[model samples]
Target: MEIEAISRTYSPEMACVIFCCRVFIKTAAAEDLEQFVAYGDIDWNEVYRLAALHRVRPIVYRVLNNTNIPEPTLTRFRNYCRALSVFAFERQIESARIKQVLGQQGISVRMYKGLDFTKVVYGGDISLREFTDMDMMIAPGQLSAMVNVMKAEGYVCSQVEYLRRFPTNFVTNKKDICFYKRSPMGRLFGFEFHYRPTNFMMDQSPGFDELLGKDSSPFTHEQYYRLMVLNHGASDYYPNLRSLVDIVMLSQGRVVDVPPKLRRYERLGQELASRLLNSPAPAVPADKPLLKCATLITEWQLTATPRSGWEKMYMHIRFSSSFLHTLRLMLRAMHYFALPNEKDINNVQLPLFKLYYLAKPVRLLNIPSRLKKVFS
Candidate 1:
């Protein structure tokens, strides 16, 4: 189904959240901050959700610092920033160690995202951005060797290929994905290694690995690279605000210059970020059905609670790539939610797992409510 946002779609609370979040990420100018905050009586809860969903908590914390925010809410913001600081520290160490190990074997690991780019954005303070895991891109030929090296280093590397999850040979980059941790039951990955960058479907990027031959070390000078990442995220409708912030900060910083050829793509990202800050309404993707639903659901979910079946289905449809994909994802999601990890192995075998398929219909019971919500 084609889902699009009609004019003036976002609620007032969401508008403020977007405005507040964008201005903070785009620029830290004193006057700009004052004007945005002056749009007073902020729904602090909505601000929290926007920050949390976009993974820009530290930046949001900075904006809310000298304001009249409530005690409990302020405490939550402080705690989140503190926790992210500790986590980013640990990831930074692991990323460094991984690069060291890989470098020993003649692989140059140039880290991006997470702590790597935080310095450019946060005035050299790596703690300002949360780093849940590291994203590494290496040569395609070294893929197996790198995995073997990581496994020998006491990291539990998952066997799943990034190809199954995302495109490896995208329009621009060649990338494969893998996750690693120190233990089998680790809750979070220590690293998320990619052989290449994520690709954008619309914009054509000169593949980073192609030009560098997997030998380049300095990402700070690669204008096309930064432009490509921004274009990739924007074209694909990435939900995270940090991505837009990445574009805004990269544009503001002197770290990289936009190459003449890639400036068009850079402008695409720059304009989108500007829209969030200046537009009268949200930057809802009317052309992209799935993206449209996601924006709506996010706005709705952030401002209100008590999700009815109708709302869930309305979101599930748009989130799915297609009708069949929805069924596939729904089944997968149901299976995941239905089982407890602590269940006895003997009691829950393959046959028992198959029983979870019954949940498909239960999840989709109100077909029309979802359809109605979308069409209306």
Candidate 2:
């Protein structure tokens, strides 16, 4: 399945931005960050913008502050990313309280993504993990209980306005429920409760019987690592760079026997992460056939970061590394077109609410030409 790598070209500025971000990783050596900064003449605004796009400003902010880069620019960047640590801390604390309540109520909850990811990847430091929202998972049967518990924890019910414009599949297909709330400080926060974290071929979501068996051992917690790898690289249409960061950090010096299906993407993720970020990623056995075509997908995506709003989303879903990935993208699109999201159910009355299904194709057909211009 090898084809010549697609000729994806990146501006020098974007490449520098990407390189600088890798320097902030815990595994990155200070010498590398210093040497790159020493010779690079970067536009501060462009670099900041790119870092913000990848949601790595917290790390980028730290890198800029520690370097000999001008103080005024660093100060401005600091102010912009200043809220990250506080927000991350706030989310962590709130999530902890919620988890405690769930435990006392005989309900099960596991933190993943935003809060827990930082602990694993950033060594339990809240400041290092900047995320869009806090994510947790609970059994489907406990969803109602989870909502009540969150409400009691001072979280108010809020709707995802964006989902109103999309199809039901967009929300339902993921098999996760997202809840929104406004913090005491007037900041909006979210908690995404995923019933199925990753529906990849390897999904072995704990059956209700296994809820109490959540492994505490770092190594033996096989399900945690499995979900992390699949969500970041294989199962998702939009791959997160942090997932690759996790693999490099989590799998280093290990010799676990990875499933054949899972191993390919695991290796691909590490290699792509290493290539894109200019970081030292762990490697799999060389004898295994490489998905050479993935580089193009990675290259196209890595170079185009710092995009916002629509452009960011277009890249997230449109970029593909392989045949199966393209098919997954199509399936997701079908979900978006045919499935009615929570917004639809709320705004539409029962019985007539079924019309929302009819609305998907119509809304898709009506997607503004400007929004479609990127693909063209």
Candidate 3:
């Protein structure tokens, strides 16, 4: 409902106060409300109902323009968030210990996804980012041994069974080998053991090792930070304003002599921010959508680079126009029948290559019609 309509019932001054409170709580949690209110002259009673409503509200708008709330009220707003922070901190401490222990066993384990995310994004440890458990990335060959090591340290492998057609989900705990009833929520988070990140994509790219070979020095926390930010953008950045705020936090603290290794990462972050601004995706607020997206894009592009053929392909597909998305495979298919991608000494100019690529979807559309005539 419009603020004006709602204001008719309450005092205009009270309505204005409530509106300000809503804006504050938009980004600042209820625990932080007091500090935010200190800046304004509004009384607690004036905003109590508003804050109460905020606690119960569904956070309908995923994006917001600005937040003026104080930081103090954040803790009081929700226990779930506080629980999340405690869980993350404990998990990080545990994971770090596990890493050290596993290293001594001749089994090197690399931390992946969430733990790395907390490390890189907050600059040291963002225990406040509300992560559940820890996820470590180990080589597929090393998974059995790694699992055993974890099991000895109070973690039992989790087993939730779903049909094979569905994408895999796993959570291992200290009690059971697998718990179909328990989610990966707060217990033992998912550890997606992958030799390569590119394996999950539409096209196989060069593995993480290939990228590491080409100057993997700044490949610690900052690398993870860039990945999470980009992944969030791709996923439309679900349910959490704090996730986007984490991007803002990660972008800070580089005013002095910036490292050359992170230059590419910084550029990528900038590009993400710019592109998000340009598209103004569904989750972005209209007021600062472009600005936020552009900022994120710029920071990401600064750190990430295409390392393999698969990486290159992913980049091309992800950044390509819609037309490229539909026709890329078709062009590959037609290479067998038409012209070659190689540079011949004669340099034959066969325009059919372009024609075939362009007509891919149309050809797909005709298949049904052709079948109908045969059936008739």
Candidate 4:
């Protein structure tokens, strides 16, 4: 769809977001944005909120700093981008220190996601991307050694106590662990150590060895794009414009041979991007229900609309490729909620594991209230 068509179909806030976040805006799109800004009645506050929710505030600021937005809103975006630059610099320093510490122990680390994309895709402008933690992939066999090295370097793992008590169980079930430490300057840095790129059920998904290579080289653009697609599916399409934007940015000018099992998600992502970001539509048509649910969820996220628990579950189930996949996802979700995390145990003081598992449902009754608080 063209920019003008999107502006007509969606709100002006969404239209501006789509225009500002395109990977490569054509002359026609730029003219459309100018015309929309000149004539369309736009709510600058809603645009700012949407940009922040979509995690594309930096990109929006870069594209619209010279536009006729209110001064206060532009200043807010400018300050946010500046703070992100400082945080990115601190993370870079901390990441280097982590690599040195782990390298001394013979652990080969390959960074991925925002840490790598900020440099490779965004041309080293880390402010353009928002990421909470640095993702590092390591060999599965070296998990114990890696944890010990991180702990020795004063980094604390989030599940340290739980892992200590149930090392085998945790390692067998979970794919990653997060470790955090405060820098000397009082800045906190987080790193997620992953043994795998994604937890998708697709058999064609690449493993750590294939992604890292025998010599532990960096991932090629193709490998990274494959991971991004799997991750989008693994996350149930994530219900955000940034998720689709990442896919578009990575697949630009590239031929990504998505596996047959994961093509539906790729198609849905492409469809959403095409509708919102003016990217070319997918050659294959998307699943109608999945696309509709994804579109609704994305719009709700942009508007800060509260969603019911049933809606969330329905969205997750609709992302499944088949009935069997939906069943597996349902079972996995059940198991996840049943297993008591450290926070749950800390809050409840349960004595028996079976009791904790039994009480999980009762504990989840507060989730609605929590959601209300979040969206209030």
Candidate 5:
């Protein structure tokens, strides 16, 4: 019965309901089971057994918050929350260290995820949000140099085979998650330097010089700070409620002085938030529209909860297969969330689709002629 009570708190059409219920079953806390039976007349024991197969912490939190479960089940949720808090706190420390390191090197680094999030979201302290990487933006030409600096400090580039070797298109499509394992303390500390934003798929994105100009403008540091928050949530499509909250908290009463043209970008930020609270899960087609699915996923991640576990798994599959597909999906998902419309959907056309497609297959054959064409 308590399960029924818990289920009533969320949307009937929630894509993760089944997944959430599975988490409930895992606790196998008898008080939760008894409450479920008393309220729903359903077999709680069997459901708990089945839920063991899933790993849905978000759902588990929701159940404990919504249902009349036993104090022990509540205690388990509290413990989970405490652990996440500790993890998040450590991530903040790591982010601060990275900022300090970049400052020492005169690299002009700006924080995007991690500890910067604390200033954005309400209840961010207790929300089920965590940052795994300290994403910092560096100048375009300085990418290799920055990597070199990190490597000098014991950071290593990822060698996942596909990522080990990059093509001409890679710089435009993928942002490498460079890892730094600094002896013992460094093992727990790694930094991600993004030469390109997730919205690099945009046909008219500004260049590094433009970003520098905007950042260095006469506007106060607070205005630039707000701009970064909007850019991260809307452009990068970071998936977490706390991200929006970060923008809200950091930009509070500080957006009045933003440049006029830059303010236009805020529309996308607003759209991202609206989409999150409204339609969290959107049904999209496969194949030609794979980009559409990806954009939706990105939107949800930035604005709402992740699109769904299925969406995340699907993207992981597609991205692993092709770098071009990875970029395509990133672009499509962004458009779907930031600027969704049927007419807008019909106009989606990625310029590099053909060149990347043709180039990748020929490279695999090791054909001298086709390879020559690619390089030539």
Candidate 6:
């Protein structure tokens, strides 16, 4: 869709965001961006707020730095981008060291998203992308070895430690575990080790070997595209501009053959990217209702509008591909939220695991205060 259509469908602020963060290959002309900025009704403050909410501040800054935005607004983005660049550089060095340590222990790792995409998709411009943690995919059988190696290197596996006190079933069903450590500068870094490519609730995740293929080469564009689609779906189709940018950049010149089970969600993601970033639409048709619902949720997320639990659940159901799929997701969600996890127990063991469910409601009552602290 065009910027005018985006403005009408969403708002002028969102249209400005699209103009600033659209993929470089298909980016609107310089004059077009300037024209949007020139409009008196344009809210530069709202643009900055939405850009930061969508985690695309760096990309926005890159496009608008030379434009006529207010110096105060431009300064905020400039300072954020500069800080992100420094952190990204530090992360790169730390990641290499972690990868080398794992390699020496005979564990082959494939890094995904985050820094990897910054290099491959954004041409090594770390300022254009932000990643909170490192995602590494390793063989399922080697998870124990990988965790040990990371701990030896001073990374703490709190998730693993939490799971240890739980039943074996919890450990078996996990798709990944995160290891965290503080750099000498006191900057916290997370390294997530994945045994499976996607979440457990999703369709059977591809094996590590299958993703790497026989020769175990790095991920091809198609592989990255497939993983990206699955990850986006797993995230409940949240409309993140950085993720949409990845979709546009990775699908630039290739036909990505997503698995049959995941094609619907891929089309949903493509439709979102196509609408927001002006990327090419997917060949497959998406369910209209699902698309409409997703668009509504996207608007809410991008605007930082609060969504009630029921509203979120309704949208998740609407995004489902089929009745059976909806049922599965609902059941999984209920099982997840109803059952007490590490957070509920806080390392306290109970004679009956069922008892944790009772504490669930009490724990949920504290959410409002927690949210206030976070957003204050």
Predicted model with the maximum lDDT: 6
Q: What are the models' TM-scores? A: 0.61, 0.73, 0.44, 0.84, 0.49, 0.85
- Candidates in order have lDDT scores of 0.54, 0.59, 0.40, 0.72, 0.46, 0.74
Expressed as tens digits, the lDDT of each residue in 151-227 for candidate 1 is 78877643433222222322123344455665343546566665544431222445555433455554452543453
lDDT, ranked from best to worst: 6, 4, 2, 1, 5, 3
Lowest lDDT sum, 10 consecutive residues, model 1, at 1-10
Which ranges of candidate 4 are over 4 A from the true structure?
1-10, 23-28, 200-206, 210-215, 285-289, 301-313, 344-356, 359-376
Per residue, candidate 5 scores C-alpha lDDT tens digits across 1-376 of 1334334553222323343433333323535444543455333333332222222343445554656645665566566667666666676776677667767877777665445544343234533544456667776556655665676666665522222233333455555446656535333666777765444333355443444344533333354444553365335443444343334344444443333434333433444433432212223224333344345644344222535634543443353335775677666665334432222222333344343444443344657777689999
- Clashing pairs in model 4? none
* Candidate 2 per-residue lDDT over residues 306-330, each given as its tens digit: 3343443343344444568667766
The digit string of per-residue lDDT tens for model 3 on 1-376 reads 2334434544433333334433433423443333433454544343333423322211211111134433333323344445556666766776687789989988876665565665565445444344544554455456556656656765543321111111122111111122111324545543444444432222333345533333424454445444444444332221123334444444444332223433333343434432322211224333243344344333332222214444333443443335665377445434423322222111333344354334444444676678889999
lDDT of 4 at 257: 65
Per-residue lDDT for 193-249 in model 4, tens only? Answer: 887665523334566555435564566666666677777654446556677777877
Q: Higher lDDT: candidate 1 or 2?
A: 2
Point out the higher-scoring one by lDDT: 5 or 6: 6
Answer with 1 or 2, whichever has the higher TM-score. 2
* Colliding pairs, model 2: 167-339, 168-339, 168-340, 168-341, 169-335, 169-339
Model 6 pairs in collision: none
Candidate 6 wrongly placed segments (more than 4 Å)? 5-10, 23-27, 209-215, 282-286, 306-313, 351-376
- Clash count, predicted structure 1: 0
CA deviation > 4 Å runs, candidate 1: 1-9, 22-39, 160-174, 182-187, 200-204, 209-217, 221-235, 253-264, 279-376
Report the C-alpha lDDT of model 6 over 1-376, residue by residue, as the tens digit: 6888768766788888878877354556878788877874787788888888777888888888888988999999989888898888998888898899899999988777778867777877876887799888776677778878888999987666445555354455577888899989999989988777665455566665554454655567777777777776544465577777877777888776776777677777777776667677846553776678657856764456755656656666677767898898789768756766667667446666577787677677876578899999
